[model samples]
Target: MQVDADSFLSGSSRRWVAHYRKNLDRDWQIPWSSGTALTSGEKQRIAASIAEFQRGEASEAQDYLGKSSAFSTVARDPDFHAASILFVAEENAHAALLLRFMQETAIATRQHSFSDVVFRWLRSIGDLGWSSRVLLIAELIAQDYYPCLRAATNHAALHRICDKIEYDEKAHVRFQTERIARLEAGRSDPAVGLRRGLQSVLLCGAIVVVYLEHRPVLRARLSFGKFATTVLRRNRRAQRAINANRRCM
Candidate 1:
């Protein structure tokens, strides 16, 4: 039931590679201004949110490449291997975009946080499959956050950055989900069902944590109820589509 793995994965890799090469030297910079565009509280909210997200973005794929390399020893597709490389490149590109946003907003990036430490620790202990699932959960949260930020901002520069990041983050979610699906494709029905159940639980927990921690930005854009509504709607819809592909699994 799964799509042809070699074609799907190889094509995806080729597309990503071509895209990366296509934009290799594009020059884009935030339009800087002497005064911060956001008010003090909004600035605080943005700073708080961007700092954590930027930290997360910075380390998104550096650890995964090693695991992908190891997994590829048993798998034959070199393009799949090459795709992981492009995945890292795309994520690091996202990180750079975020750093520019931080600098233009006058918010200094933080090197460390308790959340990041815990995320790194989690990454250290898992295999590539498990680790990517964890990262996908983060992406689900990001898929919500960036769109909300885009809606809340009026500055042309911030708006465009959020727009670009949100677009890429959504694709990142699909890419990771497809990778995980390939691993699940051979599992027994009961096992696949259990995994889907666990995914729902993890997605729910991740949503709560993100909403609670990011209430300021959420409020800047939406009430808590609406934030919950918007994010859960998107996350659940996507998760359902992925889970419903049990036949493929």
Candidate 2:
């Protein structure tokens, strides 16, 4: 469905942009000392998991800029473009944090992974809203990932990193939800139902793939049942938030 240019940069988007920009300049430095060391097995699992996450973070959507700018202008929110730049910067900063953490822990980052490649592919070729869907998928996984990694590791520095990412992710989910809500809501009633119906299929496949790939790390802390439940829970929450986003209008 085509976005009403006005809906694209709704009041929700403006508030989020300002809220995120405020933190854009804050010092991201965290203490690197390992207060509690990781077990060998834990390190191995975490390193593998984090390397994938680092690669995920190590991107800014240069490809999406032109498309997004066109999207926002038509949406009557040229400022949405700048807002998106800051949003990407924030995500990139997350990549930086993950990279530094990898450096401290001596985790080797790969050139590509099956999951990252597929996710990038999803983000690159689809409508602009598809990228946001991919992002929400990542955030849905992260909603469980960072916190559990923090708990299972017991490393102070790692905890610090997870805390920052977790906080940002909460807002990130909200941001994506708001934008997605705008996009989905702007559609005709039948379009809205159809879009959501299709979204459910896509989301389920992505969730399964992510859970399996990260199974080692996720199993380190959560049983598969627990992890799957958590993913479902967060997914539902995001869907609810998107549905409720009309309040922001």
What TM-score would candidate 1 get against the native? 0.83
TM-score of each: 0.83, 0.88
Model 2 residue 81 distance off true place after TM-score fit, in angstroms: 1.2
Which runs in model 2 stand beyond 4 Å of their true positions? 1-10, 27-29, 34-37, 246-249
- Give lDDT for model 1: 0.70
Query: Scored by Cα lDDT, where does model 2 land?
Result: 0.76
Clashing pairs in 1: none
Best by TM-score: 2
lDDT against the true structure, each candidate = 0.70, 0.76
Candidate 1 has its poorest 10 consecutive residues by lDDT at 27-36
